[model samples]
Target: MAHPKEVAGFKLGKLLIEGKTKQVFDLPEETGHCILINKDRITAGDGVKAHDMEGKAAISNQTNAKVFEILKAAGIPTAFVKIASPVAFISKKCDMVPIEWVTRRLATGSFLKRNPGVPEGYRFTPPKQETFFKDDANHDPQWSEEQIVSAKFTFNGLVIGQDEVDYMRNVTILVFEILEKAWGLRDCALIDMKIEFGVDADGKILLADVIDSDSWRLWPSGDKRLMVDKQVYRNLSTVTAADLDTVKRNFAWVKDQLDHLRPKVHHKVVIIMGSAADVEHCQKIGKAAKKFGLDVDMRVTSAHKATEETLHIMKQYEDTHGALVFIAVAGRSNGLGPVLSGNTSYPVINCPPPSSNLVQDIWSSLSLPSGLGCATVIYPDSAAVMAAQIIGVQDYIVWARIRFNQLEMAASLRVADKKVRNLSIE
Candidate 1:
């Protein structure tokens, strides 16, 4: 099919590719971007069964835009640029990876069909991942990680080696888990999701393709009967006008719920040092805390020497709005954490400055009196992580940053493991 010459004022150069539900067109003037236009058509069983649901294009574009916005804010790299129109969006042009990465939190649908005898709704801890080669005629057959690395398929001059495969696998799980937690906040369970990747002109691999109603299985209120995803459309035995409308309504509900998913809550972390000597240690905690967008305020006050001044500092933060976390940095009979924890209605973390007698220093912070609920961490980074976890309970943005860091750590471990494996004598 010939592509449109112009769409939403952006001139379409050529028809790049077409899928069952979307079409990609190269931008004539934009060298590195393309326009992806969603179609009203929906399909199942590898396009053997299909329907043209009204208003689906606009609904899908809206959902995809919102989902990608959240993901990009979470620091996940994606090809999505911005929404171009009601039915289309702008994206980075890339040589697409011919693989679909699927992560599952619960066993159902094709998973149960492929692995017979496995009961439906069997939960998978850490989530199970499967890779499928992108071949529609072949029903997107499952491919193992070993097979993926062995294939060594190159896209945009970048080879898909074991390292790359490991990175993608880790990222696929992160994307699913992050979105899963986001949905969980809205009382919806993200059962499973399939995502694709692509290599850009600069040879950087990124999450690509559209992620809307058709990409995942979402069960509202943890009940499969109340699913509000493309599965509802696929489950229909016989298509009818009213059935399509019901499916459309389900899709619209998902889009509506997403509007409330991105949190607007403010979070702050106050790092209080017992003496000027602990300023360096407290600053380290503040540095790490700022990475997750938590407002960090460093102060100098001795809980033992100036009790009134210390209590005055606590009163200020207690009066501030939003979620707050306090980090107490002190050594030699540390009392800041206990004092702040006892006085204020906020979480307090104890991170003592390193000294010659490390064990003795830790004891001061660790061995706290009963009823004082202050937690202790040895490293500054650990203290920051604990603070982020506390703040993330109310802030989705911070929650995403925490998850993103976890993904990076997991990827690094995989690379280290691969290095050790290669060093072994053959």
Candidate 2:
């Protein structure tokens, strides 16, 4: 196979690295970017076995690009830029980390071999995680958190310490869970998967490497017999021409399934207020909702004065055939939440604006009538988060954004604490 010097009009400068099934080349025109070209090759057992399947590169690139698209949309930082061609993609140039972070939802494959007594389908409550040092000659032995921290490796001027390890581990588990929920929506089970991370020139750690059928053990409808992943190729002891053809078909099918993983229903948040005067408060909620990928629609109608109009608005949204949560932002004598909650099956939340009689306004929202299960939040942003959570039950992209936000919050606190402790020494 010959490596092309130019791809998508970008001149490939030099081969940066070559892996079992891909090659990384520096882009001469793009200082911070590179091109990753997938090969038609697949390997397992640390390259003890290898095979070349026609068109596997294209299939792998398609799956990887789609997976990265979901991750980037959900607020996870990654190295993927865009698909350059059928078998190649553009990416941020990063110093690759020599660790393979694996997350498992079911006890199978290597886990079963490592732990003899564990049954084949044993489930993990929180999905187990493990790290392996990438040493093909040594079979990539598993490393403990302590081992990773003690190694103190450096990548792009950043040290791999306790803090870095923690970040990578949390993100690894998050990546797995996000994709697991996505595949679950398609009635597929993500048994387990491995991922790698890298540090770019800016020293920011991003979710790097490729994720495709080669990266996971996927089973359709939770049945192992219907598994469609690289495992099928790995399990073949004596590969004949006919066996390779079957493996190619499975890869193609996996790529096809990813095309339908995105949600068909557009979940939304509807903010209904008693008066147009509350538009500012509703706008605040709308802004926060959009941050988490929730579509927001604001309307003004009074449950006390324009009762029929308010119910009509609720019915119109319910008939749209999409999941929606209603946020009532009425201040005085708050009855909008109760009316909307009682009329529709969708979740309702009351966010009362601050007024002269703030105490009474809050009490009115808290003290709801019987069978009216509407929740109340004082801050507008909190109401948006609650609505996102309610809709995120079935929306993987929204759920991932919310989860990633939580991680960012925790990281901010850690940074703040470190600064405070340093201040005392100064």
Candidate 3:
């Protein structure tokens, strides 16, 4: 078959494959990587009916790329490499498993069909996962673990192992959690979702396929009473211009919301100092805090010599409000982290300076009294990361920064791997 005319520029060596909304083409530069692009077509009922949905490809491509980048940045494994264009993506090619993994946090459609007695709005406290084979003729039968293991498919020269199945289960839940938390911030209920995975050259399962408006059941205002998803479009018996317009509007709204979505950041940095001489350490702490968008204030006091003064400073931070992260810097049997952690509910992180006696410096932070819940880190950078994580629980801005850090780390590793692979080619 001839390659789609839409795929250009990357020397489309061969037409690798085609899916419902996308087409894969071989990349001339690399043997294992390929480019996938969205097509401007819509289909349902196993392509029994189809329509030319203008601008659908661009919307799906952009939305899917954004979601993939977000998940990848958050340290979720995925098959995405980079967004090549609005309708194109460069990805590491892998044999896709012929199954769709559906994770449900609340019952909606098919579950209502399969389990007729189950209520529609029933919530799964910890979420539920179901796998369906990708055979339209069989109507994608739900497969058990035994069935999957027995089929024994091989991809990229590696057999899918029990460990991989378990890993995908864990990773799928995390993907839902991340997106669920993201949408929750916007006051939307992520009713349920589906994701697919593919094995890379090394047999690592990565989240594959697209996750746009079509992938999840989204209920704005947390009420099933107000449902806006693809099912709304699918349920329409007649495809009138008015009905199609409504569908387009719903998709447009989803795209608009996603485009404007910014992770919220409410960060505060509290710097506790042992003495006036520790101003340098406090500056370092403040610098680190700023990287994660934290507002830092350095207060000089001794945890041991001036316990009352330190407690007073803590009270000031407690009263100021917002998400707080405390950095304790002290020398010689310091108690700032433990004292701060004990007094206030905010997280405390210890970053002690290197002293002539490293053991003493380490103990000052590590040896905490009972009931003290502060964590200790030797490096200032690590302290900032811990603080960012604590703040990320409530703040999306810090979460985004943490997510970016994860992406950069992964990108660096991939770059190193590419370098090693190129050496073999040369």
CA lDDT of each candidate? 0.90, 0.91, 0.77
Write the candidate numbers in order of decreasing TM-score: 2, 1, 3
- lDDT: worst 10-residue window of model 3: 1-10
TM-score of 2: 0.96
Off by over 4 Å in 3: 5-8, 266-322, 338-346, 350-389, 396-426
What is candidate 3's TM-score against the reference? Answer: 0.76
Stronger candidate by lDDT (2 vs 3): 2
Better of 2 and 3 by TM-score: 2
Candidate 2 all-Cα RMSD: 1.5
> TM-scores of all models?
0.87, 0.96, 0.76
Pairs in steric clash, model 1: none
lDDT of 3: 0.77
Residue-pair clashes, model 2: 0
Report how far off residue 200 is in candidate 3 (Å): 1.7
For residues 1-426, what per-residue lDDT tens digits would candidate 2 score against the true structure? 677889878799999998999999999789899999999998889889998888999999999999999899899999999999999999999998899999999999989999999999999989999999999999999999999999988988989887788889989999999999889878999999999999999989999989998899999999999888889888898999898899899889988888888877667799998888889999999999999999899999999999999999999999885789999988878889999989999999999887889887788899988999999998989998999898888788898999999988887787687678778553
> Where does candidate 2 clash, by residue pair?
none
Provide the clashing-pair count of each candidate structure: 0, 0, 2
Ordered from best to worst lDDT, the candidate numbers read: 2, 1, 3
